[model samples]
Target: MTTPLPEQAKSIIKCCRNGQLAQLKELLSEGIDFQLFDSPLFAPLNTALKHGRWQIVRYLFKENNLPLNKKTPPIIAAAQYSKDNTTGLEIVFAHTGNTEAVDTQDRTALMTAALLGHEKKLTYLIKNATNVNATDHSGMSAFLDAVVNQSLKNCDTLLKNGADPHQITAQGDNAMTLLLQNSTPNPRLIKKLLQQQLDLNHKNNHGHTSLSISQSKHPKIYKVLQAHIEAEKQMELPIFAPSNPIEVAIQPEKNTIKQRPLNEEKTPTKSYSETADDRSSNQLQDTQSKQLSVELSSWFQAATSGNLGLLNKLKIQGLTVDEVDSKGCTALIHAAGSGNRAVASFLIQNQADIEHRSHNGSTALSSAIISNSKSVVDLLIKKQANPAAIGPGKYPYITLAAAQWNAGIVSILADAGAPVNTLDPSQLNLYHNVMLAAEYYSNIIKAKDTVRVIHHLGLDINQTDKEGNTPLHILCGAHKEKAYNADDSQIANLTHELLKLGALSNLTNKKGFTALQYAKKHHLLNTKGVIYSFMS
Candidate 1:
């Protein structure tokens, strides 16, 4: 039977796991050993690292000088445990300078990060000489991990960092075979591997080559592979071959050779026929192009004008509803943006792609939010549109709704599992959205409601952008001399709300300016006073 832990040990372990840094510090200062182990599992440093208690982990490392370069280092712990807390991983990397450290599973920090689709950590590791193609005990390479996880972005990153596409897994499946075997094969990824000139003829353990495996399951991929193989075969063949039996019969042994005229009579006839065929093909192509243009224009007009009958007729006439205009706006996108509920409904019912993004990355749901169409937004969400999808300018649908102050749309999206704390690719958070809303709308009521929604969702009020500026800093730095009239009371209320919601006052931007400093620099006495009161 396993022995039970003492109350003091349990308390210390609890503090580390729950991120109770102050409590942990108090316990450590008293009699609790900083190096106390929880038997066969973890030490205090490991416990803190495992739970992603970065503050506690840092304190133990800096104050106690706890070594991080163990058999299982804190870097691996941070890679495995730190989900959204990338700062902890960065700190561990900065302190240890060991990106290639492996854990008990023989998995390096880079492999762990790639397996979990941690792009930031993976990038850092790649930059620090960590091998991109390192495999774990299971013979799963970081590239294979990214492929199996279906993380296309990570796959691209690994490929760009020189991960071998031809590297086979333990099961004898290379990247191409594994990717093609996926239920929903990423065409882009497959094309990328194809461009790398992976061995299509290489068979797996199942004796299935890329062509043979994809022939039955993935016809599109099979066709692409087939065409490539045929082209390669053609390239391998000699350009000048015997055209007739007479030439073949008169081959190597004969000394005399008969030469044809440079300008044969049949050449002009063949050239004339080829030109006639080209003219016919061009005429047919022109006619088809004109017809397709007219059809697309009519389809777009029907969608934009909310003519359901005309849309139905066009669909009956074989017009693809999901086809985009020059701007990449599909019929559904047009209907959603125009607030034409009936037309949008018809398009959805007719199987229009709900998640189709425009050229600017705007989805149908985002367009509805932009048009302030609550019903259209609800319909799109009901049809299973991704509420967390980023649209034009890298703004999420929820952020766009917040910018419009459409509380109803925000609630709908939130209920549909839209993340309140959704960050952009550049790490812009809800705080950034609040600033964008204030700048774009300039409506005090809308600004207040945006803050209210953010608070209600319990998102990180203290979250900073890449520049390290919090929402408070952004609000304080707003130029009052801009186009809209500055509402002092509204600004004060927003600042007060941020402080009340635990927005840190001492946090500085990259330029070494706090919220109060920004306010003072802008000469906004009201904003400065509010911030000062909070600090005091």
Candidate 2:
């Protein structure tokens, strides 16, 4: 049994936690034995770490060099904090060489990173975290948590790092079925996972295979699975389905130079990359797009400004209230986002679609909760909006509500029959929708970034696609694993192979940029080096 820490020890820890580095240093200079804590958490190092005092933590590690206790490993503590930076975590790796340290829950830092969708951190940790299949007390691995939370990049990282997605869930579900049970089925991610050779024939404990799970709920993913099965008989990897209104599909032919399991000398494991356009024509299109956005954005201006008279005028002018912008943003969505309760209520009263989804898959309710529009949220729920609707990052409406820190909204959603795991915050583990949605907005921010990947396999490195982008340009701005981009022989061998494939560094795309030029424009400096090294 642990004893209470002495007053002096507690004060030292307090200084560490509160970032009182000056006081901590003074106390340290006075020769205080900092290891007087009765518990691991009370230690100055962990206290500094838990509170994100990276400098103090670094100071202790560098000066005193205290042996780390497993009660809260540096990586695990870093993973726990949503805002922890790479430099803070680097302090740990610089001093110590182990990331496999486990917390009380048997959860490794990688699992916490994956559970929270810390893609960049997870990539760095993957090097030392060889136990990609490590599980928590609840038998949840990083792969399982990634799929359940719809952490696309984390899933890709775990898969690449040798996480066994085939590992059964506590509910006895395979990777495919488990993924279907949670997410809306990202057909792009689905095709990639299936291509990893997951079994479609494998059944869950409920006697349902991936085919059954996807066939009923996700017809697109079902088709993808069917296509894969067919392709298997012909022994070729299946290409993505055509673009649709619902699910975005993958096109593998975009960048397939050739497959060699080689990586760069640096091998920054966190692989994620470049874009170009006709200089004048592209500027003209961007201006037009902005003009069109302004025109469409005015659909909700009347509502947001609380000018019901203007709204009525727009209605009289044949502007349907439900009319959406190019991104499917409706007036109601706009009202909800702006927290204009009056307009939101008015729109709802006049037959606004409560559940209409924007191009990004967010609804009016999602916008409302994110904006802390408690009144609008209550109104939507009372009007019978689907409380269980999955929003951005594939999180539940209640889960998204929880992220806003609105107790009232969370309570309302819970009472509205939200399909959530728990209402009590204490019971909310990594798998809970509440925790899953914690990183929802962060994931969405990364969603817009084209995380380029240097493909291990390719058709012709010099081959030009319809966009006038050669394999090199696609290498500059391609999606690798999730929204994070990977690029040029950050896997060094792929770069050498790219050169052998006759990819001309000087060959320009429609944007009139060569491979090196494209990489420069896209800020793919690593790729620039790779292309430059192989240039004639």
Candidate 3:
């Protein structure tokens, strides 16, 4: 009973799905309809969003003037398809001010994000005032969705944001009941719910309370619940209020002693008497400050030298773990930047701030990437540091890693939700950064690995910079540079990777020079031959 999509509409969908922004723009300029929906239940905007094509989505909204207040904003689609890169979701949320909009199923975008276990998307939605307890037609709240999907992080986030733990689903299953039915129940989740005082005696649709269900199916957890209930019943807590204010009578008295003459000899100790509290407090403060200073200095050195034992000792002595150096870099930042995994782990275990940015806007995560420390990067990411955090000069942390030609760091960042298409404040894209990497760093393997990561993230290999120079143009220019120091085989391997990623050989720069033309003009015979083969 459905009609087939027109060929033109299919082309629009194809352009959006493939992230062909230029082609899509050209089609739109020619007066192509932007509102056409295809058989897969997607319009041009939703199609781009569904595929994580962020650039195309931005173009559709910014250039095409797409309305964002529809019953289902494009953000819902973006959140549903969100992967490691949540930049698209962030963008849609920043542009569209409708976090409360629901789809036909009465499901908010937060619910969709929670159901899909997209923690970054869920965090963004909850921060933007998306009702955490808002339910769909089935009365399944975002909190319930998180529990059902076994997204422990999302559950913690929802609960911390004031989601009611006792909210029952349309199926009459509360959080406790659902948690008990999990194939493998998480002890931490049960403890957290109990700590939050979730209703232990609440019943489900089958008239079965959490205690009853646990007694039959989950005996170990049932014991935990029972113990918690008994503790609450037997504990007698007291409420203490502040004592009433007391008025003391103050009698006027004569001068206790005569003032000493200016020229008179005075004893140093007899000049003033210090109270016990004042003397002790002053000595304690001075001693603590001196001790803290010594500990912080030792801790900083220990961090850089990968001395975990000393770090732990300092932490155990009550040193501030997050204390920064003169340059405003935390001890964790120093450990991460110096590639000290052991010290970084010790600091993290001791509760250092992983998301703390330095004076220059650099974070421990960015420092780890810049140092080419994969294990440190993984550790920071595991601790939930902001992978997409921007540093000074408005450059994303991944941009710095990509520019260093550090493929291992790039892979780690990609896994931590760093977007491949991040642009710097200077309008330079990842391709540009990669090209710069190839130019400065003669390590062809590193350049190739960086390119591989960019390709894997679904970024366009043929994307041009502000100068209209494709990555091919930059590579050809690099081949001409004597300082590049890359041999013919290395250049050939780089060329092959770019070609594999669909880099166009015939694309020209702003100077009207194609890659082949640039290579031939530079008198780089080997590079010219490789370009010819790819172009032909």
Residue-level lDDT of model 3, residues 138-202, one tens digit each, is: 88899888877778789877765657667888888888888888778888878766645678888
Q: What is the lDDT of residue 454 in candidate 1?
A: 76
Tell me the lDDT of model 2 at 171: 67
Q: Which candidate is the best by lDDT?
A: 3
Between candidates 1 and 3, which one is better according to lDDT?
3
Inter-residue clash pairs, candidate 3? none
Give the TM-score of each candidate: 0.45, 0.39, 0.45
lDDT of each: 0.69, 0.60, 0.70
Q: Which residues of candidate 3, in runs, are more than 4 Å off?
A: 1-293, 478-489
For residues 1-536, write the lDDT of model 1, one tens digit per residue.
44566677788779888999888778767774444343533356767876888788888878864334346777777777757346667777777777777776778777777778888877777666436677777677888877766777787667555576678877788878887788888877776666556789888889988888899898888998987664333212111111111110100110111111133243344566589886886778766665565556657656765779878987888777687776667888878866899999998888889988776676788778776789998988888888878666666777667655667777788889999888754466766556544433435666667677777888888787777778787777632323323355666777887888788888887878788876776666887788889888
- Pick out the ten consecutive residues of candidate 3 with the lowest summed lDDT: 248-257
**lDDT value for model 2:** 0.60
Question: What lDDT tens digits, residue by residue, belong to model 2 across residues 254-349?
Answer: 111112222225433342221233455467765655434333434444555466776776677666768775566777887776678888888888
